[model samples]
Target chain A: MSGDTRHGVGVSPGTAVGPVVQVAPPVRPPDDEPAPADAEAATAQIQAALATVAGDLDAQAAANAHAAPILKATAMIARDKGLAKAAAKHVGAGLGPAHAIEAAVAEYAAQFEALGGYFAERVTDLKDVGDRAIAEVLGVPAPGVPSLSGPSVVVAHDLAPAQTAALDRAHVVAIVTEAGGRTSHTAILAAQMGIPAVVQLHGATSLEPGTTVAVDGEAGEVTLDPDMALLEAQRERRERRAAALAGVSGPGATRDGHAVALLANIGGVDDAVAAGAQDVEGVGLFRTEFLYLSATALPSVEEQADVYRKVLEPFGSRRVVVRTLDAGADKPLAFANLGEEENPALGRRGLRLCQAKPELIDSQLAALALAARDTGADVRVMAPMVATAEEAAWFASRVAAAGLPKSGVMIEVPAAALRSRHVLAEVDFGSLGTNDLAQYTMAADRMEGELSDLLDPWQPAVLDVVAAACAGGSETGRPVGVCGESAGDPFLALVLAGLGVSSLSMAPKKVAAVRFALSLHSLEECRALADTARAARSAADAREAVRAAASPELTAVL
Target chain B: MPQRTVTIASSVGLHARPAALFVEAAQGTGLDVEIGRAGEEAVDATSILGVMALGAKHGEEVILTADGDGADAALESLVALLSRDLDAEEG
Candidate 1:
């Protein structure tokens, strides 16, 4: 602690000490640029700059398969003949090369924004291309994450999805952002990649590059210029944590043998393969949105089944809980978009979106059914954003019609959690998506990093909601599970289990720590800890109380 | 000169991946090709930005015209590409 400490929200767990690498914000064209001496030379420079940006993006696309299509499309925009002509016209009118490029991008951006929906989202991509070309023309470093030379901490105002996708996983040890909530793309990507990450860290981008900083992801603290002793202590704790995690394996349970199924929350085939190879029980949340997110049209049933089969085949005879397409205004599909909405979070999303386009859900269910027939894995289907028994029943009926074995609903809405018994009766099981549950419970936007205090999972109101949902599951004799970022928190896992959640699903990297926590407490101890947390007045108090009540061994490494 | 009129089949219309693919194919043809809605001004089909600016929605009819060598064959190929859902294919 012999250094200045800055606090933020910890979205991923780990510890690292590395030199800071500040991500430069998008560059803007200087307003006072003199007209080029020769218009012909200026136009040539603009074309050359755009071509260089396109060439760089083409190389990036060739290197990363996951971001290939996006990068390639962006490259196409960079090499666009129309855009070049527009810039040339501007340069002919005596505008500088950089200014000309900016004007040209702005024109297209305005058109795209006017179109709205999927087109509006592309404006970011278009503007990103503009920034790169401008930087090239002005002879400055490009915006976004630069190539890492060693293990370093990446500090940024916020990372765009394309920037996060292009991260060098091997060299980047930690991620710190000045803005983002727990469910933001940066948080989710860092957690998925098992990198130490902290978000909402004030003045994070102001940290000098090459200055050493020690980041404690669990504590959400960054210590600038830490002493040797503190660094040594962090290294020891990391090693001890790894050793302890390696000591535990197999199914998750309490010391007294109260069985709690530990599972993985996976998005695609790659995650499935990686998590399946880990020592977890099975997949608790198989998010099906990835299959549709990148596509311009709904995938054919066979195409979806092929992907589903590949995901399922890794876990033989193990349960794979598949959540159907959860797209809405917030994460709109290109083809299934229900137009624009003023409030996407509260609008037609999840079950509501499915209801609007029955064909979308039907095809997904049909594909899951077909894939289940092909694989040995036990697959169950669920719908997200379900708020009532009627919605649950409607989804269950659709699942049955599709010939799926079991059906379930995500208990995210506070209304659904409060009346879980009735909802559970209509479905086989339920999983609490605590992230969305917290958002809806607090009536706070999950994307707003400044309001993260209200969205904390440890909040008494959110816990009470989870308890209500779990109570419904118990009353109906159906198992309820938690499959959210909260589930990955080792301490919070104890509180959830105490609330009678039968299962916990999280990033596979987090399973060992949670399993270790569960092993340190009996069912009674966990229940008592839950009671203590519920009795606390605030989220911070509840967290502190639970930490104080937990086993010393669990608290030591944490 | 040769031309054909066809409806866009990609559910998301002529934007994103479909627009990129169409533009790439049009450029590959090395013919002067143009696309637009009936009774509307046409744009260079080889320009990705121009094709996207058309804002063609799914199932909307768009006329395609091509001139020079192998114009008919290129128009026929372009029409066939537009008839099927190009977005549905695996990238």
Candidate 2:
């Protein structure tokens, strides 16, 4: 279609060729004073813009009924009095009705972000309303290339919320954003939708609409204008891999039929509910920090109870292991503000901070206990960064006193793993937070992209920690689960299963792949994978060894 | 005006739960009490946000003050409450 096009990191692995679909950003012409030159005329213009945006949203909702939930949520933002008043303020600030809507929406979004949580979530919805209003005001399509007839990779400079949310999963084979990160909304949503995506490309949007592209999400590389052979190969691989993984279901059981729990690691109560509502076995890890992080002050006991209740309700009687507030200096709280630390990751965090502030721990435990009592959900509470047996006992006792049935500790610290037997001796269960465990064992900063080499869960030392913790778990007659990014990798999941982990908790999208991996190998075969990984000299070697031992189908997914 | 000084007994000092508890206790009293570090201008004790904003540390001395009816008794009770660890009681 045009000269060779190039772009940024290819995160998801796939290939697609499609007609170029150009998505223009929502246009907002500077508001010109209406001919009437009165407040009432400006008001009517704003009203008309809002009505058009609402109608557009209704049309979209009808087209994608499944999007009703998010759309309804956005409508509330569109109708928010705060947003309306703020827009009116912008008019007084000397902006036209169109520009005023943008200004007001942006202001409200910023304020909501400052408030955080239920309010912060409104930011996305507000932005959506603003985008639609601006688009309607300018009589432009709502900033997205829609209705692609064939499977294609979507390319963009930096996708806005409306653009990303509007993506049709059926037509979008992959996503390549020129500017974004792993934590960016586009990447996260793409991952959620199970669409391969790469971000942080230099010239993603410059590619002609409807061009052939190949993306390797795992390798984080993109090849623009790929030759026909490479495109075909990627397409074939994607199909075969998707088919193979789809064939797997049920629990993550060993080849010999030892049932290993396949769980989901969720970020918040909503995620926990959504993941737990699935046919999957249970939730291996539910991160509770989101509630605290989303609030400017500590969430009240009642507020925490409501969130915990929702998270536990979906799983019903299934096990839902909740990790208590794991925040610290790195992700400090507004109220529990720990002053700036030189090395936040290694500084006060997880159980260490809990120990210092037992009251905070007590309130959390009390809330969990109250929620458990109300829900009657099979729940277990755990603390993160537990190092000593005393810490484990301290946390366990507190949890028990709060009326919770069981208490567990996350074996992420090297010391805890090395002495897991003693640590597990004090708790009802142990779950390996391998991401942090690997980071700590290798003494690598997780935020350092360059140190990604050392942070691999396959690292020999990291595997040793898993094995040791599993061993400790075995000694205590308590089960342990691996809940980290590694658990999603089929090969690494197999290795963990081989090492005696009773559960693998990861993203919901990765469940099928792990289940397939576990089914392909017998306990002996998986044990061999773990042993080989243990014998490997480096993280890369360990990964290679695991890859060599696993089925090609599973290895490809990895 | 009545005033008394007491150490921040809670391990995390006067932040989060302890601060919330202090604010609650102050609310229970019908007085316009102000809490502040000794020698520092006191702030409204009824304001949990304000008391937490003080960020008083463990072993730090904070003065409680109030005016009018029952102010003396309210200050005395608050001083006693702040001198012992509430977390220990709960534990």
Candidate 3:
């Protein structure tokens, strides 16, 4: 086992020891294999491999329907005409059947990435097809472990898109990818799946498969061949966590019975529909940019409307708060192009772009209104990066004109939060985007991992912004909510409620834990807890205060 | 071919609700009709999905196209239908 050192990506979380179970990489030709006597035989092999990949994707999708819609869509592309036919053309070009398949698939995948948006989504599908075809030609199981049958720390050098998607999230305790970034899709998905994953671990592929390992997600560490005692301790911790998180439901309220709406922040209409199907109260932040993210130009008013309708239809009478496009130079669009700047986040983005391009804002507003009218849902629209009351008022007026009932502004800028009263006065509600708020308040770059300490939501400066925003919300009589990562945290949720936030929005999976935490304390207790946290000197001290003040059960879960 | 002018009633017109309505109307006519901004070239109108995909906005002007028996009548009726508010127009 030690000699093999099979390398691939470590996806998911947890550590277990088991036998080697390599999900071999897709079939490919031997370096010295002679030309086949019959082209027909090679063609047949390629076709069979493609069909097999398609079948695997379907099976995986059916098994994990709740995972991500992109999985199913990628499956569709694997069997698409553009891809299948493109591979056949390579055969005509006289490349080996396996080489033909790999070359053609790569071309499309590159094209999709270049195209971005919906097309860029196809990159994973193309990679899947390529891997499978090459594996079939080479006579090996596709790369990565096919199934983690026992508790073991799986090792991998690099992970492909499908390999990452096909991860058995339940069995895998933690993931250590040799080559990947924290912002890579694998990392994002792992975080969303509640699995501790550490990427960019050098020599991950050098570890023997089935070796006992320990992973610390918060620390981004993977310890290979851990002692038996450590494994037992980790397992005990996990089981305790499960018990603590059990029975979380209904609205997230504090011990004193102060009610704070618990909602899910979703990216697309599909996500809205799926999460809405769950027990979530309503959609907290419906990222409206998805409707236009993949488009060559700004989505037409009608295009935006159709999506809004689909998104709102799921929530019905439930409130669906739509956030207008948050794109900027960092997330540039071909149609709504903004030139590069020294700092994309601080540069023209969010509400600033909407100001420069009222037509884009108008189009989004019109669609949202149409969806509201069609679905009869309580729809609300909000603008991102509103630093001034003027921007908020400008956005609100447009939303009202578009025929939507309510409009609000996201207080991501400290200036906006400090003057939140005035900004909220112009809008119907306020939602604090804590991630951006923290970044801006502390003068920290979000992308800079080294500033992770400053970026902590518990940072005094970040909390100060939240407190100011909440106070502003109260002054204006407009309800406020936290829709950033901090809201997903149970202890923080209580503090936010104490700060006068009316709602807490987070990933759907986190709602239960937060709700459970809130139920353990009263509104007054939560207020006291918030004060204790605020009085602390640093983020660490503040975090400790929150933990100490929280109920034993909540503290244990943390 | 027949032509008519209509404001995209749905605030974000032609792309969302207006587009859906236009697609439905073009489908009903059984005429090879096209729709587009007032002065721009029109796309195939019969395909509801395609028409909606165009993303026309509220209060925007769109030209309609069709040919053959009752083509003129179909274009006129469809254009008139498109001019109205879609939510009220829908059954």
Off by over 4 Å in 1: A1-5, A28-45, A59-69, A88-100, A113-121, A136-140, A225-228, A294-298, B1-32, B55-91
Error of 2 at A242 (Å): 4.0
lDDT of 2 by residue, A123-194 (tens): 666676888777766666765655456777777766666666656677777777766654355655676677
What DockQ values do the models have? 0.53, 0.02, 0.05
Model 1 C-alpha lDDT per residue in residues A475-525, reported as the tens digit of each score: 999999999999988999999999999999998888888999999999999
Q: Decide which is better by lDDT, 2 or 3.
A: 2
lDDT of 3 by residue, A387-469 (tens): 99988889888987887788999989999999988999999999999988988998988666546567778887788789999
**Order by DockQ, highest first:** 1, 3, 2
Considering lDDT, where higher is better, how would the candidates rank from best to worst?
1, 2, 3
Off by over 4 Å in 2: A1-173, A176-190, A198-210, A216-223, A226-239, A553-558, B1-91
CA lDDT scores, all candidates in order: 0.90, 0.74, 0.71
Output the number of the DockQ-best candidate: 1
